[model samples]
Target: MAAFARRKEQRLSRPDPSRKRALDARAAELVRLLNARERFCTASSCDGRVIVTDTDGTGIQKKNCTWLLVTHDPCVKDDVMTALEKATGDVVFKFEPFVLHVLCRELQDAQLLAVRSTHCLEVPLSHKGTLMVSEEYIEFLVHVANQKMEENIRRIDRFHKGLELALEAAVPADTLFPKGPEKSHSVYMHRRKRRTAQEQADPSRELEPQDDAESSLALFAEIML
Candidate 1:
């Protein structure tokens, strides 16, 4: 009865995959549109965000944050978690005590996959894809995920622009960060250069969002076409 009561409590409190799917089903059309857009990001989106903190010999630190926020469609998250669970017949998640925090069942390097939500610094086991998953489907998810990210970046860009404009107008930039995507993992950006007092942006510069945005969308359309 105690076990039963505990299970009931979890069922009430958590937003499991099934609940996510049910809600996602309501916006299947939007999902299809997003899947088309994500494939355009030349900047790798699937890997977890790896924020690099540089400590020069004397220990004065400089930080560079990579915004590889791979927002997910509910159905894709459900299917991937489901596949991982099915492939390994266990409740293999962080919440499960005794579940190895660093997994190596079907993977080699743990630095590849990341969960977006933790506030601490930790690396995770990354896997490319499971058996028999079609390229078309993965591409579909990539497109949608990229689209969602593009939309997110747009808001971020706008907020930054708003800040610049506000400074120009002497108005306080009270910009808001959207809460649409979950921060499951940190983007791992290889430190390409040391930060100077003048260098506040990321040291390793990837293609700007606008640079590859159109090409990515076009490439996805070509594939789908």
Candidate 2:
């Protein structure tokens, strides 16, 4: 009886090469079909509990994973909580309150589909693309970014100078800036004129005064502001 059992075990352990080849061929075919498809993802809150699910190939339930790609079985984990981490070697979706719909091109453009309850919902990627971000608009954004950067530099320079002046006079930092209506350009210009009238003002600092060094510095400041 023992000899008969051993012989039976030996026959079962022998490799079945032809069957293995058939299985491999089937897997290759499935992979090709899956690759040609794209998976769409969406996030929404339903009721109190978040339901994260996936629908593939005409809105059928495909494999869910750490990644939510159009993939075969063998998911990331054996079970899932809020979201499943899929290691299907497909695109992974982070564990979140979201759902993904995997659809073929026949359904629509891959980007336009999102998962609804029964049917996969079509997210309209349609746009008034005519009012697009033109080259001019792109250039405008760059210009605005540069202008803001320049303004920031001017602010830093002004703050540094104000700090130095405050230290020299042994005054509080806040004293460098006049408050209320005195904050305006007209007020600053008025104060400058008064200082000039008092002669305590540096004649060199006068706006149009022929002091080469101060006039050049003032011109540079004006451009910066």
Candidate 3:
């Protein structure tokens, strides 16, 4: 519909709001690829990260926590140790894998890429600046985090390839990308209206409820651990 296209354009034109104020290098290509298609646009994305944060006892409230170090690439033990020096409360080291939130033009478009799993590692490394684990254990944890980072990259690659294949099969190559903004908008609205009518006429077809921007259809591929 014209409304959805307009919203996508408005969102894309706005400034990036993530802490880094930019797309992660690892996710940049995939984001661009998806944006090129009329049926999908990325909402938010994180390629992966290794982080050290000083948190309260619960470690769940970010408002009371301080991020000491954050890196997208695999980090070494020295990096964690260096970040630990800045800790004033309980310190937690975390390895978070790639995550992407995509807004699809249709429910079926989202289903094409839907994947769900939950896996992330967080270890409480220090209690009030005092080491709670042995130096060797810290080294081992860093090694494991590094390995997870590597696996995260591979998963991203796999997801990219799979998406490419899915898009190719779902959309015609010539129409997958529009030539210009004006033409793209017109063509997209026309196709959307036609699809809407078709779905409405088909009594067996199930319709998804219209959602607000915050509840837009999303596709996610979480790390498997």
Clash count for each candidate, listed in order shown: 25, 7, 0
* All-Cα superposition RMSD per candidate: 24.5, 29.3, 9.4
Query: Tens-digit lDDT track for model 3 on 17-118?
Result: 999999999899999998998778899999999998898767474868999989999888888888888888899889988888989877666666687645
- lDDT tens digits by residue: candidate 2, 73-167: 22222232223232222221221111222323222222122223321112211122122234354344334433443443444344334323322
User: What is the lDDT, from 0 to 100, of the residue 15 in candidate 2?
Assistant: 58
RMSD of candidate 3 to the true fold?
9.4
Candidates 1 and 3: which is better by lDDT? 3
In candidate 2, how many Å is residue 195 off? 5.6
Q: Per TM-score, what order, best first?
A: 3, 2, 1
Give all TM-scores, in the order shown. 0.20, 0.21, 0.74
Q: After superposition, how far is residue 104 of candidate 3 from its true place, in Å?
A: 1.5
Model 1 spans > 4 angstroms off: 1-135, 170-225
Q: Which stretches of candidate 3 lie over 4 Å from their true place?
A: 172-225
Model 1 RMSD in Å is 24.5
RMSD of 2: 29.3
**Candidate 3 at residue 180, lDDT?**
50
